[model samples]
Target: MTTQTYTPNEEKRVYAGTTMLMIGSCIGASLLALGNRFSNLGWPLSTVYMTLAVIFSFWGYRQIIDACTYTRYSTIRSLLIVTWNKVIAEIVGYATMFLIFGFLVAYCVISSDYIHSIYNFFSKTPACNQPAAYDEGLCNEYIKCVAASNKVDKIIRAIVGGGAFMLLSFVSSVGILSLISSLSLILVVFSISVILGRCIEALIKGKLAHDSGGWTRREPPIPYKPDVWSVLIDFPSYFSLYTLIPTIPSLYAEMKGSISEKTKIIHRTSIYATVVLITIYMLLAYVTSATFYGSNQENYRQDNILNNFSDNDKLVLSVRILYVLVIFTAFVCCLFPCRAILLDIVKADRTTKRGKVLFFVTGIIIVLLLTILAIFVPSITLVFDIITSLFGFVLYLGLPILVGLKIPVLKARREYMEATRAAMHRKDPDTEMKQTNAMEAKIRDRTNSITAFLSVFGPGATERVRQASESIVRRMSMTSDRLSIGGRADRASSSSGRRLSSYRHSHIPFKGVPSTIPEASDLSKIETPPLNNVSLESEHARQQSRLQTIPETYEHDRNRVQEVTEPDTEEEETTHNISTRVVTEQVAIDHSHTISDEVLLEGFTPPKVSLKRQIILWTITSLFIITNSTSFVMTIIKIFSPKGNTGVCPK
Candidate 1:
């Protein structure tokens, strides 16, 4: 698709799209499903889980953003490929695609259900012909009407709706994407306000009952206490709330900012977006639970929370229509990334005929598969839990940590080598030197903190940290040749061509070899002195002095040497001097460009690490592993559990 490309430091007229998109993405049909999921766990437990997720997710997001600051790769897949091996990158990349696909399928299913809800709400029923509050008998009659409608006809409608959504997303231009993204943000805020208003209104009217810390009935007095088992089982469903993490990287790429300030911009925007999300979720959960959760109304916990409200309520009907718009735009938003991943994996150039065929064929297959799942499988929570729990951990936590660890090692080598190479060439190495020093200092501080923290856990922990850091440096060294060779060639070609040609014609200083042969010493034995501490100005002065003496040395040679019996001896000596200079220059050029094994090892070594930071990192890592494993197990249980959805709709 055609798109606008901005220069790195360009200014924009509005708030960054990353912030708006993050907010919009977080507020979708998922909100409709969350009320029911939270009801299963009491509000207290749900709040705790959500709070924990936000905290950890923010921490993990920060790590990924920091890693992005070091590279120019816009796609997470490309970043992963560079940070890790291609195999691991491919696996995680495809897994991320699957995650997005699952969410899209869930959206399709919910949209279809909402459409039916709207149609049934508007159609006249025999049980109660007039507008009134929701009644079991009346709802049952409406349900029966929907059930009795042509199954084939309903399926056809679902297919048409889903297919159209997929097609619209597939063909959308960059401008269209941007427009919908902006609109989705506005719609999200509006919908949340309306929903929140209705819930608060119910509370104000005393329609919602609250007793002590628990939601209870007057006659039964049964308290809702969520057990740990229930929390663990339902955790994935709620944790899926932060499934927006992977998409943030791409949004950061699109945001306008200078290279130095991009990370800060995205991080600040993320904080704001997250606060908005937390406020919306917590308010909706608190108000909705107090209003519709527990008591004899437990059956009112429908997948689509709005289904609990009376279909006759004009406000709820408007919300439903508004939600449909949100879903339509959100579906397209998600489709863009999923489609991008698919194209990337197949290595398709969308502008080509072969690529066009593959794009349509894959797009059709994806739409059809998801449409089938949305139609046949009825539970949005289960699908969400399974997909999000498994892949969310990988994208949100696992890969970010792995990628973060590798970045310092790669960065250290690149910056250090750049500085060292500049120093050898007598260029102004000040900028590169400062950057190298800063990187090293940063790595040193991090390492020291890690080692210091780990010391409390005994020497074994500290040793492991040391070993891991060394191993990373070693692995990076192995890859340095490829980077260094290409980098040097590019710098060489881009350097001043006229200067290089002049240097070749005239005797000029080169590293590791003398500019001319000395009569008193052999070329191999004449050692090249170290110039590591040499300043740029001093080197320039020395070169100019050497140039001035060149003509005088020629005059001295001509005057001092007597004419031999052979007349052409002077010509022979001049020819020999020219050949010797050229040979020495070639040798110097070769030696200057080649990086030895000894230099590579010394320059690419990691900074010294301490114990404290090691302990902190280990603690966080252990927690991550525990959470991922728990979620994976929970996802399995969620998938196999016979407990089906019990709600107003068929699902």
Candidate 2:
């Protein structure tokens, strides 16, 4: 039966949808809630923590790249099987999936809280400028009187909020969730713009000044002594914690590329992005703190510093609305991957009708459960931090290093035997047995060194492999001389015979071969018609004839050879020579019965981190400290020292 292929629509959706998913999923509810939490620390400590989180994130990304390179596996489940046992892999995969689902639940709850707060605000606002309406107790009694007269507004608000969440879940399940996320990103951008503009205005007008005299003269400055403990515990830490879960899928996808190259990109991008995000967060925190301080206002209770500036700033109000909308969209986008990953862990591939049904049912159940939990859970931020930190630390840092070490160790011995056999086959017949044995020993040592070096995660692996392969080619040059001195036709036939003989002697069964090795006559039983004699009536017919004449086993072996051979196409002779050497080397190692599974599954022991890695790590650590320090100094200068006073009051 022919395999079903993805249509253009499906393929387009997968790539575009996935990219949008990454961008939207990256931002969430933490952006809104984190400002006040960090404000308590002032600005200096907040900037420092943000800088450090980025550094650690980059390091974590590099570790993932390293693990994926040696293991050559993309999915967490697949990587786990190679590093640990199958049982452990399955368990870890499931646990990670569950953590993602929990994030979705938290986002839902936070969204509900925001909607509830907005509703409560409108419901408490006085309809007319009546004293009875303004009085707290009178207003409560009037609201009760109004609710008895008109309960529709209260009921509608509840329905609108609850309905919005259910609609978001439904759209997400059908895979249109990314479109919703894009809309959310737009909202977030607008909100950030409003907040940033207000900050810039405050900074430019010197409104951040501290007053030395009551409502009069200002102090020269006091160094900003931000609460370090509060910053770490409440602000920057929460942002890092929230971003951790969303960071996993993107890093995991990046593992499909070359590990060494991709690790650098991930590391650099993470560091740079963190620095930028921290700067923005700190500036906003400082402005809000300066405005609200000494006003008997609790930091967390303050929603927008814009409200304090003027109720007439319609532009700022509009921006605030956009910001809230953006946050809401981001919350919706974050739910998709959490659901997707959970489904993956459960082995729900969505390929069958039954599987699709299961996905919908599971999503509905999760939403319902989360909505119930939201009623009881006081702080979504605390729950998010505990769950994300636990899983993100384990999956990103611990798993990759463990897997990189395991696979290389199991595969080393087989490569050694192959190198030994090739060296023996090339030696002169007249050479002393002891001398030939010595030469073989030298080849084995070289091959082992090459294999060991390649197992590490770096550019060095590629260079070492090229050097070892070239060394083998040089040895083959010497063997070619002895073969040419004999009759040309005789040498060619003898070379082929030697290759087959080596294969037989090495005792490694060919990949497709059964457990037992077949005799020479059995090898002869496998035949193909001459390529030149194949008939062709049309292009399709010619293609079919060519395909039919090729043995499935031969095609499979050729594909394997092509993987190594295609890169060196500048020299046809060299290509053939290398292919022959590689084939002979395999035979010498008794790999005749070797299958594709054996090569792919073959493990190698990763080399210990050398001095070079230590130096790089140290360099990164130093840079992180310097960058953080610079940002902190700038923030302090902006906050405590005032240039001139504007009409805006400093709390």
Candidate 3:
């Protein structure tokens, strides 16, 4: 059978594309519920929460940037595998998968529900015809009108949810996420402009600030007295606001540029997106709350703020349409990262037919599951609450910081190895040997330090540290001995059948002399003046005898060289440090084959970092993990508490 050739899946992504992806995913269906929730917090408090959330989000986003810079891993699973062990990585990886799935289901549910709401709002005629009658009787009748279409609404939701995912699958297969993101960005800007325009119009018409005060008589910028309840209610919304942070690594990986350039792109795009999102959310929340700020304002609260506005208003109707487009585009944008992570987990080559089949199979199953969930579980509040509180904490807040701590430790080791290796390339064998001895001492000290620091993590950590240290030490010792200048000189002498240097061969006594010989290591302690004081005839006789023994010594070296040239057993290589041994053997081969010095120094293993640096990194890592874990537990407890806020705005 003939084999089919497939094209590579490489696609170019630009700065605008990256920016649009961030904004598109950030402004998902969750924003529909934001106005109501922010209204509950009022102007000052919500502004504070959003500000703090942005700061933390940016901090976490920076960690991912740094991680991608060093590791160049495209997916979260890949980064996790390097920063932690495979077992922990897989555990966290699967959890992140579920998190993304939850988000996918949430987007579907919110989008479908909002579409139904929009339809219900416009399709039915109001019971009260007059403007004054709207508040007196029509408002209540509107709820009844909406409920009357429940059966039709469910059918509409199912069709929309399923059709949207089907469209996403088709679009993804065709590789149009870039096109989708661009469109989503346009929708995002238009939607924001429309909301702000309406807000500005309300302000111009003097419909916002009441005679009671700017925000109401008692609380100027807040509706209710700021309490513990408000904080808990707003916390999850804060996490939801910056939900795009977790997907940044995948996006960073896809961008076509050097690591530095990608970092710059991410930084610039993130700043712009943050400014736009924050300005819009804060301004919209302030204006929305200002319009209806009072004890009676709670009466107007909606899961979707559009419900509070007049259905007949052209601006509001257009906003609904804009949101519908935004939701679908955003849905497609979110799917790309999910696909990337899933493919990474399965270790599938996307260019192959089997891999493509697996991807479609997985995608269909996920979409079908999400569609069923959207049809049945219609509450967006419940979905966002659980997701932002739990997965949000782990993925966005916890993992990034955890990875950041290990980065510096690895970086220090790398820099140290490079500097030491460069220092060892000196022309003077004595100087190079001296530096090599110093490096050994330093390595031992660092190993001890690393072991002590790791011991704090408990015995499992300590044992791993010990093994790594022993393996690294053994490999370094072999490498240093084999690759050092003195070692190179010795190898050259043996291979060329030349007499050894005096400093190395002084331990061998002259064949005719009966005097004691100095050890090579103790050559410095021997008195050279005694040799000078001997007679010229005796010296000539000693030199002639030493030359006579050269053939035997060369023959012995030939045999030794033959033995050293033999290939090592695979099992023996495996027993040592694999990476170190491979690199060392490569260098040995390079030397034997007369490869350049630069090529020989290329694959040296990084030495352990100083103990102080390890302490600092581990300390910071523990701090971040502890803080995130504690906050996560507390949030979870509050979420499940009997009296906890369901993140629903008060009616």
* Best prediction by lDDT: 1
Ten residues in sequence with the least summed lDDT for candidate 1: 528-537
True lDDT of residue 212, candidate 1: 17
Per-candidate TM vs. native?
A: 0.62, 0.51, 0.57
lDDT tens per residue, model 3, 234-336: 5645756776666778888776656666787788888877877787677766666655534444334455555555555666667777666666766666676
Best by TM-score: 1
Off by over 4 Å in 2: 1-25, 85-102, 109-161, 172-176, 183-186, 200-236, 239-264, 293-295, 298-300, 303-333, 337-353, 376-597, 600-651
- Relative to the true structure, candidate 3 reaches a TM of 0.57
Model 2, range 1-651, lDDT digits (tens) per residue? 433234568644544544444444455555654555555554566566666665555555555545554455556666667556888776666556656665655655544444443443455542211121146665555446545423433343344335655566565343454565567756656666776666456546654222111221112122245554343334223434325333543465653334444444444544445555555555656555544433232221333343333323456545544544544555456556556766766778776886677666665666666666555444555545444445443453345344434434433433444554565456666676676577556544433322222122112323433554455456457678675534644654565465445444333222222323347677554331111111211322433343333333343575464444343332233323333434455345444334454443345333454566556655654553444344344444543565562122211
TM-score of 1: 0.62
Candidate 2 residue 552 C-alpha distance from true site, Å? 18
> What is the full ranking by lDDT, best candidate first?
1, 3, 2
Pitting candidate 1 against candidate 3, the one with the higher TM-score is 1
Itemize residue pairs with steric clashes in candidate 3: none
- Arranged by TM-score with the best first, the candidates are 1, 3, 2
